[model samples]
Target chain A: MAKVLMKGNEAIGAAAIQAGCKYFFGYPITPQNELPEYMSKELPKNDGVFVQAESEVAAINMVYGAAGCGVRVMTSSSSPGIALKQEGITYIAGAELPCVIVNIVRGGPGLGGIQPAQSDYFQSTRGGGNGDYKLLVLAPANLQEMVDMVQEAFDMADYYRNPVMVVGDGMIGQMMEPIEFRTPVKRELPSKEGWATTGTKGNRKPHIINSLFLDPQGLEDHNIRLQKKYKTMKENEARYEAYNMENAEIVLAAYGTTSRICKNAIDKLKEEGINIGLIRPQTLWPFPEKAFQEIPETVKAALTVEMSEGQMIDDVRLALNGKIPTEFYGRSGGMIPTPDAIIDKIKEMLGGLK
Target chain B: MLNDKRIRIIVGHYGSGKTEFAVNYAMKLIEQESNVALADLDVVNVYFRSREKAKMMTEKGIKVISSAIGHDANLDLPAISAGIFAPLQDETCQTILDVGGDATGARVLAQFKQIINFMGYDMFLVVNANREETQTKEGVLRHIEEIERQTGFKITGLINNTHLLRETTLEEVLKGQALVKSVSDETNIPIKYISAIEKVAQTIPSDVDGEIMPIKMYMREEWM
Candidate 1:
C-alpha cells in the first residue's frame, strides 16, 4: 500500500510475482529491459523460474513449455522482438495454453526506432503472427493499470483457457510514475492432474499439449471453437474511459500515450468553454466499440489521434461509421505531439463546427 | 542582434536531417569564432540522431546540454543545462536546441520558452517529408501549431530540410518545396530554407528570399 516511483516494466514484474506467475522467459530489449532484470531477481526469491532465452522465439516457447505444466508463466519483449515471437505465440494460442505475454512496443515497420508508439494496436488485436486467432490484449495507460492488468491478465487467461498479452510501448516501459501494487490474489491454481504434462500423478493418463490436428475439418472445428471464445470476450470484456462526455460537442479518441494527452487537451479545452471529452480504450483486443456507440446524439464528432499514421484511427472511423463525421490526427512512426498541440486541433475543429 | 549564443530551437521531424542541421549550424558558427553551443532536446526518438554526434560537437567546443548520457529515448527527457542560459543572454553568439520529431517531443520546449523569449531568442521549426509523421501539409500544420502551443512560441517560417540521410535525392527536395509552398499559403509563414544533406542551398524561388545554410558536416570537410 506504499506509493513507489516505479517504471511500468518493474511494476508488471512485481505484479507477476504477486499473481504467482512462477515462470518467466524473455529476451532483453530496450525500454522494457528492466523487466527481465527485475524478474531475474524477484521471481527466484518467490521460487519461480526466470529464464533468459537466446531469442524472442525461444522465450515464448519456454513460456509454452511452462504453461503446458499448468504453472503460471509469462514472457515479454518489444515490437520487433515480438514479431520474432509470433510463431510461438500462435502455438500458445493454438494449443489453448494459458500464459501472459507483455509487449512494451517500440516504433516499427522493421526496427523503425525506439520511441513510444502505439503502432502495434493492429498487430496485437488483429493477430500479428498467423491464423484466425485473437489474443486477449490489454492496454494499460498508467503504471497502476500496468500492474492491475498484468494480474488481471493471468486471471483472464485461466478463465478463458487462452493466451493474454499486455501490449504497451516505450512510454509505459520507461516512465517513472507513482504506483500502488495490487494485493497478490492468492487463488488455488486450476488442477493440472487431468491433462497437464506433469509426471503421472497416481496412475493418471500421460498428458500432452500440442496443436497438431492434421485433419483439416478437425482444425476447422477447433478454430471455430476458438471463435466462440473470442465472441464471448468481445461481448463481455470491452472497456474504455470517458471524461466530461455528457456536455461535450466533440470527443477525442486515443489509446496509450495519446489517450493520456487527449485527457489533458479535454481539460484545457473545457476550461476555455469548448465542451470536449476523451475516450480511452483499456482493452484494445475486445476494443470498446460499443462505448462509442453509446455516445449521445448531442455529441457530433470524434477525432481519432494516435502515434501511428492511422492504425487506431481506422478502427474509430469503423466504429462510428457515418453516424458522425469522425476525423483523424496522427503523428506516425515515432512522433508525439505536445498536449497544447492536440488542444489546438480540437479548437480548430470546434471553430469549423461553429 | 547578431547574438549567435541565444538558444536556437531547431525543430524537425524524425529522419528529416535535423541532427545534421544542428551539426552544420554549430560547425559553421564555431568556425566563425562564435561562442556556439548545442543541446539535444529530442526525447521521443532513438538512434542515428544528434546523440550519436555528441562527441563531434564537444571536439568543436560546442557545449551540448543533455541529461544523463545514453538516457531513455523519450518525450520527458529531463531538461539538462550546462549553465549556458546565463552566458547566452548577453555574450555567446549562438546556442541551438535540437528538439525532437513532433509536437510532443517539442513540448519539452514549453519548459524553457518563457525564459528564452524574455532573453530575446529566436526559434525555427524544421519540416521534412521522408519522415512518417510530417508527410502531409495538414500533418505539418498540426505539428507547427502544437509546437507553438507547447513552447508559447511561434515558428516564423519553415525549413524544408527534406533528405533521406546519405541517400537523399534532389526530387525529394523539389517535392518538399511544393509541400512547403502549401504550408506557406495556408499559414502565411514563408519557407525559410530547404537544406540538403549534401549541403546544397539552391537559389530561393522569387517569392522566397530565405537565408542559406551552406554547411553540411558529415564524414569530411570538402564543399561540393
Candidate 2:
C-alpha cells in the first residue's frame, strides 16, 4: 500500500481495522478523539461495529464483553478518561480476556491539561487497575511505529489472552506523519474455541468467562497463572532501541515523544564533538533492561528525560540498577522537553560527573 | 493572489493542511491588505488549530479570532467567538474562516449562513490527495457535495494544499494537482491556488491551473 499522511490517532484507528478488529467501544476525549471518530465512520463500512459508549467506564466494560466472545476489540481515551476505565480494565485483566486499550496520555492527576505529557508512565506500565496484573504496554516514539504497534498489540493481547495497552502522549496522537500500514508479523495464536464464551453445542460443556474466584485458594491459583503469563511477556516481549551507543560520555534514556527529542539532542551534541547515546524503550512494561546492558563503559552518566516530572526515571533506575550514575530532567503539565533543554541537561550531567 | 472576495472560508477533509494553508494565506494577505483577520472556527480538532499561532500572527498585525474563552487555552469546547462577526461586518478587513475538517466541521458555517451569503463569501475546499478520505476524484466530489449540503454554500474555489508535512516533494504536489484538477474540471469550480512549501512551489510548472502559493508552515513545529 502507498504511504499516506495521517494524524497519529486516525492512523491507529485505520491500523486497528486493518488488523481485523471488528468492534470498537470508546468515549470522546481530546487528543485521542480522532481514533473513535475515525472508527465510527470507517468501521461500519468494513462490516464492523463502532459504539460511542455512554462513558469511559461503560466503554471498557463493552470491550470486556466483546473480548469474552473472542473478537478483536479495542477502546481508546486520554488520561482522565483512562482513569475512569480502570475498574473495568482490572476486571478485563482478571478475566484474562484479550483486548487492546489505547491511552493517548495528557497531563494529569486531575484533568491537568489537554496537551501532551508522559505523566501516565506509572499509570500505564504499573497497571492503573487492581491486584496482581500486568498489561503488555507498548510505547511508540513516532506515528509509523505507533501504527505498527497498534496492530501488534491486538495480536499480543490474544496470544497471551491479556490486555495490551498502546500508550502515547498527546503529541503522538495529534501530530501528522506519513505512514504505511505494513503487514504485521504473524503470531502463532491459540484457538479461541478453547476458552471463548461462544455458544457450545450439546456435546460440549459451556464456557464461562469470569474473574471471580470466591475461594482464597482459587484466587491465588488464578493470580499465579496470570503472573506466569506476565513473566513470559517480560522475557520474550521486551523491546528497545539503542541509538548512537558507539562511544558516549553520557547516555539519555527516554521513550515515546520525549525519545524523539533526545534523538534530536544527540544529533546536535555530536556536531559539537560531544558523544551522547540514547536508549529508547519501545515496550514500557518489560522496560527493556537489555538495552541498558549494552551501555558502553565510557559513558559517565545516564539522563532520563520526560514530559512529566520524572515518572519513567524509576524504570530507568531499575533497569540500570546502579550500573551507572543516573540523573533526571522533566517538565510536567503539558510542557514538552525540547532538544536544547535536553542538551543542557546532558551537559549539566557531564559537569556533575567531572 | 487570492480573489477579491472579502470573506474566504477554507474547508476540507481533516488533516488536509487546512489550518496550515489558512495561516499562510492570512500572512500572505497581510502583505497586501492592511487589515486581515483569521478566525479559527475549527471545533473538531483539539490540536494543530490556527489559533495556536494567534500570538505570532497578532504580532505580525493579523487579527486572530478563535474560541470565546481564549486563544491560548487548550480547551476543546466547540465555542465560536462572537468576535468572528467583526471582520464579517467590516468589509475593509479581509477575513478567512478556517473551518474544521469535513462535513461535520462545515456544519459550523451553517450558523453564519445568512450573514455569509448576504455579504457574499468565497468558500474554498482545500484538497490534500494524500489524506485517505479525499485521495480520489470521487472521494473529493463526495466531500464537496457533503460540505456543500451541510453549509448550504457552493464551494467557489479549490486549493490544492496537499503535502506530506516536511517530507513533501514536487512529485507529491503534482500528484495532488492532477487529482484536484480533475475535480475542478468536473465541478467547474476554478482551481484558485496550488499551495506548497517554497521549495516545491518553485518547481511546479506554469501549466498548472491555480496560482502557486508558497506557504511557510505555521501550525507545525520546526522539528515536526
Candidate 3:
C-alpha cells in the first residue's frame, strides 16, 4: 500500500488489474494512450487479453464483446475518440453490459484539439453516448483517485449491471503523482452469472443479451427497470470533497485537474486572512447537489472553476439555487488558471463584502 | 511607420505550436529592439500549455500578463493594468496573445477589445493540416470563422503548421502546402509561414521564417 508516483492514466490501468479485469481493448489517443500501452505490456503478463484496436469504434465494440462474456472490460480514449465510441457505448448501455471506460478528455466539439479539456463535462455525466440509460460516472482529481476510482468503477459496473466511467483530463493522464491503491477494495462477486455468458451448465436457459425487445410492454419494462436502477444510483452514489467551510466568505468549486488549482488558491487565500473554502466534486453525474444546501451560513458567494467555458458552472448554479450570490471563473481549451489567478478573483469577490 | 507595433495574435487549434510560435516570434520582435508583451489567456488546458512561457517572457523584458501571477505564484485572473491597452499610443512595444484551441479559446480576446482597436492586431491563424480538425480547407475556413466570431477580430494571415509530431518530412510539407493552397483558394487567406518538424522546417528558405520546436524551455522556479 505504499504510495508511488504515477500519472493518472497509468494508475487506472494498475487499478483495473488489481480489480481482476483481465481484458483491455483500446486505440491510441493522447493523454490516455498510456493506459492501453500499459495494458499491452502488463495485462499479458497476468494472462489477460490486450488488443490495440483498429479504431475507437473498434475498441469500444471489442469492450462490448469482452464485457458481454461477463469478464471485466475497459477502454481509454480522449474526447474526440470518445465521441466516436459513443455509438458503441449506447449499445453497451442498452444491453446492460458491465464495463468501465476512462475518458482522459481533451477539447472537442469535433477534434476540438488535444491537450486536456473539460468541454466534455456534459458528455460524461449527461450520458455522453445517448438514450435514457445512465452510466455510473466517477470524476477523479488526482493520481490517487485515478488508481482508486477505476476499481470502484468496475465494482459499480458489476454491482448494477451497468457501464461506469472514470473521467479525467489530459493533466491527470500525463502528470505523475503519488498514489496508494495497491490493495483494492474487496468486491462481491456478481450474483447473476446464470444469466451471464459465463460457461452455461445444462439446466439453465441460455442467456441472450439484447437491448431490443420486440413487444412494447417488454421494452417499457426494461426501460423502467433501468430507470429504477438510476434512481437508486442517484440516491446512494453522490460523493464530494468539502474544504474550510465554517466561515468561508467565498467558495471555489471545481473538479478533476482544475480542483487541484482551486485547492492551491484556497490555501493561499486562507494564509492571507481570506475565508475561502473548496468543494471538489468526486462524482459528477449524481452530482452532490446537497453539498450546497448544507453550506455554512457564513458563506457569502460561490463560484465554479473548470477547464471549459462555464459548462460545469451551470451545475453549481443549480445546486446553490440562488441562495447566495454565485459567479463563475474559468479558462477553456487546455488553459488552466494558476492558483494565484483564482485567488485574485476570490479577493475581488470578498472585497465587496464591506 | 516605425511606431507601428509588431503586435500579433497567434491563434491555432490545440497542439498547433501556437504557444511556441508566439514565444519565438515575440523573441524575434524583441531582438529587433521592440518592447514585447505576451498575454496568456488559455485556461481550458492544464499541462504543456502556453501560459507557462510567461515567466521566461517576463525575464526577457517582454511584459508578460497571464492572469498575472501574484507573489504566491498562482494566476492573478486578468484585468489589464492602466495604459497597456492603448498600444498604438506607445511607440516601441509589441504584444502577442497565445490563444488555446479554436473559437472557444478566442472568446477570451473579447476582454481585450481596447487593445484590438488601439493597435490593429496582426491575427495569425495557424493551420496545422495534420490536426484532425484542420485537415481540410473547409476545416481551416471553419476554424478561421470560429476565431473571427469569438474574438471579433479577423485573421490577416495563416501559418501552415503541417508537421506530424516527429514524422513530418519535406514531402509531407508539400502535401500540407496543397491543403493550405485550398484554404487560400477558398478563403483567400495567404500563408505567411509553413512550419514543419525540425529538419523540414530547418531546410526551408530563410524568407519563409519557418518555426522550429525548442528542445527545452527553462522551467520557472515556482511554476504556475
RMSD (Å) of each candidate, 1 decimal: 18.5, 1.5, 15.0
For model 3 chain B, where is the 10-residue window of minimal lDDT?
B215-224
Number of the top candidate by lDDT? Answer: 2
- lDDT per residue for candidate 1 within B96-149, as digits (tens), equals 778876666787777666678877656676777655457789988888887787
True contacts kept of each: 0.05, 0.68, 0.03
Q: TM-score of predicted model 3?
A: 0.64
User: TM-score of chain B only, all predictions?
Assistant: 0.80, 0.97, 0.79
Clashes of each: 11, 0, 17
> In candidate 2, what are the lDDT values of residues A168-275, reduced to their tens digit?
999999999999999889999999998898888786899888988999999999999888988999999999999999888988899998888889899998999999
- Whose DockQ is greatest here? 2
lDDT ranking, high to low: 2, 1, 3
Identify the runs in model 3 with alpha carbons over 4 angstroms from their true place.
A201-203, A352-354, B1-224
Q: Write the per-residue lDDT of candidate 1 for residues A49-146, one digit (tens) a residue.
A: 88899888889899999989988999999999998999998898999889999998887889877777888888888887789888998998877888
TM-score of each: 0.64, 0.97, 0.64
Judged by whole-model lDDT over C-alpha atoms, candidate 1 comes out at 0.76
Ordered list by DockQ, greatest first: 2, 1, 3
lDDT of 3 by residue, B57-109 (tens): 66777776654343223322333334345453454557777776678777877
